[model samples]
Target: MAAVAGIWLYNKGAQHLVSLAAGALLAMALLRLLPEAQEGLVEQGLSHNSLFVFLLIGLVGFFLLEKLSLFRHNHHHEHDGHDHHHGFDKEEAGRGGWMILVGSGVHNFADGLLIAAAFLTDVRLGWLTAVSIGLHEIMHKLSDFSVLLNAGFTRVRALAYTLACGLMAVLGGVLGFYVLSGFESFVPYVLVVSASSFLYIAVADLIPQINAHKGLRAGLTQAAMLLCGVALVWLLSPAHQHSHSHEMEQHEREEPHALMWSRSVL
Candidate 1:
């Protein structure tokens, strides 16, 4: 549904959509993924700084990936005797599209693990986590759809690709349910790596494209759209969970007592 909406919006104005995608990707990486990874690292008694190391490695790895993509594209075009202009060409766009999909898949997979973990702890918490994740997923999917379109993907292909990435969540959930204790330790690192992909795509690809257009009105419009994208994620953030933390704690406290009473009767 989000992808369909993105297709509709793409027909309206793809450039603005790119700006919005940029904002959403950046916010997801910086505002949500990194902080969550940091907290998890701290909980594990590991240095949160290690997250940065993984982040740096991811960025460099993606950079190399893009360079390889560009090289292959240029080589293929050269053999075909076709000349392509520089700056946000088809190759760059395609690279960005693939990178975003990869990042989104990893992020979604992590979300599934988290939701599964929550469910294991408490069903109500699991449902709440799923709801929040669904909302967040919608926002990112819309943004990702736009990027795929901008990368020259046909609407059908873009939708199909996005859905494929979305399915990774189910795979993650299954793995998490079966081996959460062993895998939970790695989720933080996965998040940090996933965040790096978003950061690289937003900064290296999308922002430059947004900056290519010149005009006070265009600049203002782009800025507004970017902020709107960030605002959407902020509004749907899980910060509200903190307010209910005490309630969850109280319920947990009562669970053992209830279990004891039932045992006594038995």
Candidate 2:
């Protein structure tokens, strides 16, 4: 569904969609994931520096991964005795595509865990968390589609791969339902690593591709699309969900537990 829509939208425009993806990834990493990870670190009495260290390691790890991808691609190209040129190399694009999938998978899995935890705590809270995640996933899927297309994936492959990545949430949900209490402490670290992946893709891959287009109108259009991407994440952020949860808790406090339980059950 969402994956199909993303493929359709990507066919409409590629470069603009890449710009938008870059923006969305940047915001999701910086504004949403990092802050959330930091807060969780505080709650766990962990040093804020530890998160940054993990973030650094994630970035370097991704860089090495890309280098390996590029090496293999170049070796294959050489073996074939063919030279190809493009604004962006196929190897780089492929690396970006894989990175997006990896990052999105981790992020979605974390979201599933959170949703499961919320449900375990209260059915109403779980529903709210699920709804919030659903909305966020739509944006993420759309952005991912754009990157996948730019990476030279066929529409069918992009849709299939994206769907496969999305399914990771189900795996996470099942695990979270059974082990959330034990796994709760690691969520923040997962988030930070995910953020690093997004950051690396956005900065190293998408931005460079975007810079290849030159013109005043193109620049303005790309900037606008990028800001729109950021705005989407800002509007659909987890902070709003947390605030809503707080309000629900406050309301439950005003009411009786039996009434709240009945409402939740209903």
Candidate 3:
């Protein structure tokens, strides 16, 4: 659905869509993913600094890949038999489309593991987590499609690649469900890597492209779109699980009674 929508709207307001996506990706990393990574590390009794290190490693690795022309998204079509060339920056964009998919694949796989963890902990919690991830992924996938288009992928190729990358989540979920304890200690680090990928894409990749345009009007419009994107993810964040408050309170209340009952029985 997101791919089709993007293809249909590609002719109109594609740049703004990219800006919105960049903003959302930033929010997903900063507001959501990073915090979750920190909490997971703390839960697993791991040093908090490791999160930062993983993030740095992810960013630098992506930077190096782009430098090597392996992750370049700049596309220039040289026509032979089929002419579909919209010259952007052929050298810079080379192979970038595949790079984005690879990054997204890693992130989605982590998402599957996280969702599986939530389900193992509690079914209700798992459902809530799944819904949250679904909403965020819709926006994330849309932005990915926009970035691919900017990198010069045809509509067909972009959609196919995006869908293919999305399947990694399924694989992760299966692994997570069957082997939860084995992966439990490692989930936090995976999340950190995911956050790093999003930060690198939003900051190092997408921002430069959008920053080239000058003019107060364009600036203000971009700012608004960016905020809107952040707002979308922020609104959908796990922090808004107020509906679980009653359940949590009830659990707390039961703990003392359960303890007393156990003691009396003994």
Candidate 4:
């Protein structure tokens, strides 16, 4: 069970492509496709002001996270006892790496809740959220597992630790969905929070990893790659990716689970 969970989380990176596809599907569900399908009544649309509100909330939420030393906090603060260099370079990712395991567990728990909410919205939404989660989790596990390995855990032990952490999503998703469903009157608020969660993870968790490269040239290159990923996601959005989510599903299917040495794709 542990190994299966580890491998499942390890595959999250591969799901990024599919996330783009999911975005495309969502767009179709909103725009050209959805409009035509509606007999007469126009569906509700997202508001820019509301989006701004969500963005503000995400900023504040992450600020609290920063204060609490949660996810992405390590991108700035160094651990007192660990060597951050060559994280898991043929070794555990760092010393006293239990901190990472703990942090990751919390982060994954939040993600599980997000997944549950998405499912409660609808099956399509749930499936999309699951794939997004799967992508996020795989990269997460890869990173956490590497950290454990860097902290002197054997590969097998590291895998075990990561798998234990990975399975937390199931319970989280179910619980979150149930809890959030009771607040259906606050759909817009929920949407805002969900968007904020995505923004927080991308900006908070992933950006720092890109910024930490040693050289100026390397940093610029990484920055470019980051933009490319965003651009690719944008291109595949329903507005451009051919009005369907199949591309994302196909892309996810093609993504590699074992990237050999790292979880850089996340």
lDDT of 4 by residue, 151-256 (tens): 6777788787777777677778777777778865444455445556555555566555545546887655655555454554445443454545677877766666
Question: Pairing residues by index, what is the TM-score of model 1?
Answer: 0.57
Model 2 worst lDDT window (10 residues): 71-80
Residue 85 displacement in candidate 2 (angstroms): 12
Tens-digit lDDT string for candidate 1 (7-38): 45544776777777777767767877778778
Highest-TM-score candidate: 3
What does each candidate score in C-alpha RMSD? 10.0, 9.7, 8.5, 14.3
Q: Candidate 2 lDDT, tens digit per residue, 66-136? A: 67553111121122222344575888878867877787787667667766765554464355445435534
Q: Please, what are the lDDT tens digits per residue for candidate 3 over residues 47-84?
A: 88977888889789867866774544332221112233
Any runs in candidate 3 off by more than 4 Å, and if so which? 68-70, 73-181, 243-266
Candidate 2 CA-lDDT value: 0.69
The parts of candidate 4 lying over 4 Å away from their true place are 1-51, 73-95, 207-266
TM-score computed on alpha carbons, candidate 4: 0.57
TM-score, each model? 0.57, 0.58, 0.61, 0.57
| Model 4: lDDT of residue 99 | 70
TM-score of 3: 0.61
Off by over 4 Å in 1: 1-3, 70-182, 240-266
What's the true lDDT of residue 189 in model 3?
64
Clashes of 4: 13
